[model samples]
Target chain A: MTTTEAPAPVRTAPGGPPAAVRAVRRWGFLLRRLGFYAAAAAAAIVLNFLLPRLMPGDPSSAIVEELQRVSGQQVPPETLESIRAIFGDPDQNLGEQFLAYLGQLARFDLGVSVVNFPVPVSELVLQALPWTLLLVGTTTVLAFVLGTGLGVIAGWKAGSRLDSILTPLTAFLSSVPYFWVALLALWVFGFVLGWFPLSGGYDANLAEGFNLPFLASVMHYGALPAATIVFSAFGGWLLGMRNMTVTTVREDYVLLAQAKGLSRGRVILRYAARNAMLPSFTGFAMALGGVIGGALLTETVFSYPGIGYLLFESLNKRDYPMMQGVFLIVTLATLLANLLADSLYVVLDPRIREQG
Target chain B: MVTQIMSDTDHDDAGTTAARGADGDVLRVTGLTVEYVTDGDPVRACADVTFTLRRGEILGVAGESGSGKSTLITALTRLQRPPAVTTAGSIVFQPRDGGAAVDLVTASPRALRALRWTSLSIVLQSAMDALNPVMRLGAQFADALRTHDRSLGNDAAWARAAELLATVGISGDRARSYPHELSGGMRQRASIALALACGPELVVMDEPTTAVDVVMQRQILAQVLRLRRTLGFAVVFVTHDLSLLLELADRIAIMYAGRIVELGTASELYDDPRHPYTRGLRDSFPPLRAPLRRLTGIPGTPPDLRRPPSGCPFHPRCAARFEGCDTHLPELVTKGGHAVACRLHDPTQRPQPAPGTSTGGAR
Candidate 1:
């Protein structure tokens, strides 16, 4: 029994703009976000250029000292000058040096790695970058999904057996140091059991391509390191999500949803978990940005040929160009990840869209 | 024992405006009791609440903060959460489609799920919180509508949602707005509209207009009355404000501590309240248009439910308490159209009063 008569309409604000026009307003918000990211990137780039130059001691001598320790070889004067040339002359006017740095950056020329002499810093970065991104990026996402899903179940049934088991177990696991866990995993699974590869990103003999054999080999070798990282990381997400879900489930809207006669699954997922995931979503974005820096100790323990391993080696040998290049990539990746988070938030919460 | 109050003729007369179908009663709640089970003693929040709501009647439950009015509502709606359990009760609901009446207290979860929204719905207080802040108004409505009847496609569900919004005087287009986007008054109205989405026969409203301004409260009450007129749904309105209920409720039930001390027609309760507690409540609200009089609000706080007072729960605060009142619990005694749970009106407590000599009401 529905009424057909027209209702007396209340307070029409000239009917809000059509969908297309509203969509453009959202773009205005996105454009503002873009402007913020651009300025942040510019600031980071300037710091990338200035930080190495402002470092104590000559870059060439630091390399020479490391080289002598490694190879027991003395660098000739000519070789020293060539190394200094790669560093763009420490005494050059600050403006001129900055311009030269910007010009080199524009062409993606990060100069040459001192330790891997004659090899470009960009090339070394590119080689290590993919390994780090693939391993760490995929594991981060997997941990987030698995953790959040479990958290929803645990929090929804807070006093049940599953909740009791998961809560304390994850809490203890997350509190343990990451490197300690990684080392333990390596020793137990790799050294003792011999169930997985002890070190490296993939089998060295397999050609690195899109083929299934190569991909399988990579995963096989990457498994222990990936598992360790995920194990240590997922706990934090689970605990955070569990706490948030506990609070969100008590919200009046969730109760209202239940009273609406919606299914339990719908109440948990759409009404409870959806809102609870907001803070966790932001944390996940930050974790993703950290992935570019690589799982340092995990990679070191595995000798995984990722960015973290490369960074460690470069630092040990005082490879200034390689260090500079890696730092810049980390900074840029963090900024981009934050930008992605801001954009995704607009999609997830309509409240943010209005502000944007 | 639970007391079934209200004269049959008066109840039928008050409810006749929109009563339909063969059976006059839509809900029959008998010996309904609710308790808060804590670490220590379990506190009885509602003790032996018995009342029958007729089709298309507004039964207003009025009480102070701790008087179990809200508990009674939650128990009726079967929405009481952990620690608050319906220990004993039978919420017998007769469905609109002439189906068998089901006792909600023992209804299976699957059965309750089927009955919810279709036969029973609730409009909660604090509309800002009751409606999901993140979801668009239409989507929430669509969710409720589609879940009950799977035949309606997404488009059809959305169209119905817009129609529901329209009935509340919210433009159909405004259904796209989130709960946070609407004015407080509008959000409450939207919640009211959402409750009516499935055309529920009974709507249990728990202080639905408490969060809005006075003007909005009046508008919302007027809207509720208007909607009930067309839709013919019964309402059990629970609030602390008796004055508001006087204007809205066909019948008012005044609760003291955990028991309903008096239940009668609004005019009867207001003009000639039989129970001392009900009189205290009526005197608490100064008449709006009438000249101001010194208000003698209730003297004492409601007793702690964990260790309630012996005998009559209201005797400690009651001015008219006699010797037997503190020693023995009083049953809600009905005489004519009014019912009062007081020894003063208990016919067995004293020699039977001659006809028309009672303290309140014309017999």
Candidate 2:
């Protein structure tokens, strides 16, 4: 029915400002996101400073006791004093100790490792970081890419036999403990089949370089652990992506895309999978952050020289400084990854850019 | 087959009327039955529905909620998802290129894709949800444009996209913005522009203006009318608002349950509704110019398609019930320009018009 009221004026400008001002407004969201990440990192650093101090036992005495147990010789008082200074002076107030800790962090001086007396905690961490990053990081990216691709297909043809087979299979694989799968993979591929090295990151006797033999040996050592991680981890990505793709496929935009006469591939990939992958990005970022810590149980089982193994060794040795260094690194890495995800999301979803 | 009601006198444009009379059968849906296959039994959502759309014609399908209006739209476009399947009938769409008419129900996936955008497109209800939130408006338009024409360069396609936006009164620069950037009304208009990107012959709209405010609704409908005048695409607009259809559509089909109960020219349905249900719907809306009156909504909710009422589906709610009303189903019988499915209008049952004799049904 015709109305007496005149039609309202159309929204000509999306914003009130002219082009230059509007262009400046676009960067406001990114600046705000950076501010959030910086705040989170500050909070994480404060917590890192406070945690070890709050623990009951002094790390110095623990080191002294361990030294006596190992050598059967009484440790000197000066040694204890030096260890206390290296850890954090028990004499100073929490405020002064916190300031000192921050200073050390700023200088990248994480103190000496208790397990290997004069070796710096940062040096130990640096040595182990690359192995874990190469192993777990590569596997995580591989699993995500392959799993998401299969998921898009499976979800697009949800009722087909391919979907029918993969859906239950992934459901089962993802639910089983990955460590158990790692053990099984070790028994089958390493122990029984003798195809891969049973333990370690690379051949101990190989001359370390970017040479062909060393790289091949590294791959040879990494293959069993990588396969096990991918086998167990891929299922989760596939299931998450499949579920999301199934839901996204039902979205009005996806339906409209189909109605637009787009090819089936276009509908599945650009329309369905593109939106579906948004939720998975957060998960993938967290997984990337965990890559810095490495897959703990899998690393222990493989006897790989990674951050996870180093942390496990530090825990057994009661090496507080090493553990604290690893924890700080892990926390910072997680924050950085989350920041990356948020920025990536702004690129992927334009709605986020408008909220600011 | 239900009778095709093309009221030559109802059209204001002489050129359109002449073109329709020459060769206007763009879409002929014959006995199109759609059913939802549930666990217990298959529920018939659209049972034996038949209608024909002429070139450049606007056929408005008006019904209450759960009246299978949406179901018919999806079925006609062959966009029905799982559980809902077209078990019978054919949607014989004749392309404007003078190609052979192809039945959509039996068409291959490749054939369906070819028809989309170029020959037949859809403008869905919620523009916010219908547009790709991640993609820019211009990119989505370019996608459809480049897809149909492989020879179109990327820059040219984008230029064409901006031009399409301009048709809907959206500025060329706004096409760079995302769907969320534009207001609700603008997004709906953008979707309309997208649907007309390939110059489709038939545009199936399912309550395209339901989500917007009254002012925006009027603006969008007005824009649709303006565009249809120039592009000349047939629209099958489905909505629950009969009064809106009375103003917009050339021919209005009123659906009750899962079937078209009455269909006629907009004026014919308004001035003299043949079926009792259509009369109830017409009276439900408050007249724009008339004095104040109590609105009389049709009694009883729509029947459940899972276990629909026997005989005439509307008989249980009928104000003019007589012998054989509950026992026998009525067929859609056309008298002059109007077609109605009711025992009261069935000449075979009544033999003659009964005046002031049996029931309290309003004339």
DockQ of each: 0.41, 0.48
Count clashing residue pairs in model 1: 0
| Minimal lDDT window, size 10, model 1 chain B | B10-19
Q: Per-residue lDDT for B1-363 in model 1, tens only?
A: 112222233233221222333378888776789999999999999998877788899999999999998888878878888889999867778776767777788777788888899889999988989987778889999999999999999989989999998898888887787776677888899999999999999999999989999998999999999999999999999999999999999999898888888888999998888888888888887898878877878787989998899999988987666676777898876667577788877656843544233234421
User: Would you give me the overall lDDT of model 2?
Assistant: 0.84
> Over 4 Å off in model 2, which ranges?
A1-26, A51-86, A90-99, B1-22, B290-294, B351-362
In candidate 2, residue B177 scores what lDDT? 78
What C-alpha lDDT, on a 0 to 100 scale, does residue A1 get in candidate 2? Answer: 54
Local lDDT at A249 for model 1: 87
TM-score of each: 0.90, 0.91
Which lDDT tens digits does candidate 2 get at residues A41-137? 9998888777666767676567667766765767666556544544556788887777767767887777667777657789999999999999999
Work out the iRMS of candidate 2.
2.8
Question: What TM value does model 1 have?
Answer: 0.90
